[model samples]
Target: MTCQLRVLGCSGGIGGDNRTTAFLLNQNILIDAGTGVADLQLHELRAIDHVFLTHAHLDHIACLPLLLDAVVGARTAPVYVHATEQTIQLLRSHIFNWLIWPDFTVIPSAERPSLIFVPHELGQVEQMGELSVTPLPAIHTVPAVSFLLSSKASSVVFSGDTIGGTDFWQVVNQVASLKALIIETAFADKEHAIADAAKHLCPSTLAKELKEWQGTAEVLITHLKPGESEVTIREVLELDHIHPIRRLLQGEIIEF
Candidate 1:
């Protein structure tokens, strides 16, 4: 089996030409629901059966309501939303609230909701068909989580949106079977103070973070703030202990 990942959105915020963060795993498992989801083909839109939300940030989940609106009428099975209890509550009370967006849960029928929220505790793994996903806590403003997805042949982790931390690095080091790590680097080294204030990682901090991790897995960077991509990549290029440190470009596909 082939495990594919498509970058839907990779920037920190939306500009007239930039998109926020989102990614698709195996075409069926969506990592986030940023503005890029609007690019999905109608048929592709209808095929998404599961969404693994990292948090309730507007930039991370801004497009979910729209995506659900696009496909709710066509899905045979209810879309499963896997997230932390706190994150789910935020979505329910804020984004999906009847005031902001239509509560899709009651759209088709309340008895059998079209969208099912499955709260996942950090550190526990959930099996979804052929994919196994484990939610890991991420250091961010809200109750965010990163993920470790494994199939029979390969496994990788997606760091939703966070600064460098010991917990995620420790978990990655122990995952002997880890093949890749898609982490977020939102700012350049020059913006260290800004990055810190925003609870995001720049290349300088990311280099320090990587120094503490033990492994040679592919280090794929994502969530680069628009217009600062070049500087962030330059800073990453200066790091040691690993090679093939590639930036996660929007619309790019990765097979693990």
Candidate 2:
């Protein structure tokens, strides 16, 4: 069977028709619980069984608490949230402290909690039915990671908000059957300095990263700053690369 991914949101900021990063994998697994999760109906929200967080950034984890609250009554089992140890700690200290949001991990009663935190390390792979999800290295303002989603036939790589670096491509180059690559380029070429400071990528930096990749996967850019998306895409297209790159759109689906 093929693994299907639905892009719920892929924008760097929120605005008209723009949403933060979130992806639905086969209807039950969420790659990130960003603002895009808000668009789902109550019944759709109830279908999420697992959430794999890239980091603890507000834009990435914004809807997680709200999602738990909305689906609590409908869920028969706890929703599993997988992330790095540091990311999980940040969630507990900041988000689920009962001050900012109710600690769903112990809410309704400790015996029947609504959420469970599952910590994963870099390079470790987790199996979800027929799909395999592996955490890859990411350089960001916080402890973050990219994800490699693979089925027996093909694989897709999601480079979560990160700077251009060799470590990520090192792992990505090893995927023999890579079908698609969804990477982030958060700023235009003119904002290269700002992008570097924030540990994000501009078109120029993205070009540098692309040089390390050897596969022929279809490249899709994501996380462009709302107002600067046009310029960013222009600069990305102007770059010299072997693979064709395009912007990732909300509501798009990719099956492999």
Candidate 3:
């Protein structure tokens, strides 16, 4: 198995070359179908067999419909989409409800539909190909969860948009082989109130969160707002002594 991960995008918002969040794992499984998925070539799109979504937010799931539409009949099997049941409801009620897009789950017929929904729960672990995926706790405005992607060599936890909490760090500290912690710090100190109200992290809270972690995973910051990227990253840089934190860039490849 090819134990590799490619970061397609990690921006908080779009415009001027920024794409939202998406990650391709082993070229066959996508962690999130954000706008970044648009960068994949045709063949690459067809190769995706599974997509695990962290939540149903637009930036995180913007390309899911387009992706399903792109690979409808070209592949032999349905593309399984994993998410929490609440997220599934959001997608069904808002996105695939025929008004917005075709419900591919039963489109060509239920027997051979193009997309499948797999409802997951916190602490649930799924073995997809050679990797083990688990949902971890996260506190977001809407219900959301982080993910732990593990291969035999190492593990990487991706914290989808969230306000760091004790429950989040509790699960993270248990992963003995964690190689990297790909997290979100969407705002800077200047936007702390906005961040708090939105249930997102800024540099200040990120530091408090780090104090609860008990692992050696390299911290890779993600989801910085376009205009605040520099400020947010600089604030995060001040916490390097806590956990080797750095900014995660689009198109970067992380291998384990």
Taking all chains together, each candidate's TM-score versus the true structure is 0.95, 0.98, 0.98
| TM-score for candidate 2, residues paired by index | 0.98
lDDT of 1 by residue, 17-106 (tens): 677888888878898889888788988888888898999998889888888888887886888888899999999999888899989888
lDDT of 2: 0.94
lDDT, candidate 1, equals 0.84
Q: Arrange candidates by TM-score, highest first: which order?
A: 2, 3, 1
How well does candidate 3 match the true structure in TM-score terms? 0.98
Candidate 3 per-residue C-alpha lDDT over 1-256 given as tens digits, one digit per residue, 9 for 90 to 100? 5478899889999999999999999989999989999999999999999999999889999999999999988998999999999999999999999999999999799888999999999999999767899999999999899999999888999999888799989999988788899999999999999999999999999998888898877999999999989989998888557677899989999987
Model 1, which residues run further than 4 Å from truth? none
Q: How do the candidates rank by lDDT, highest first?
A: 2, 3, 1
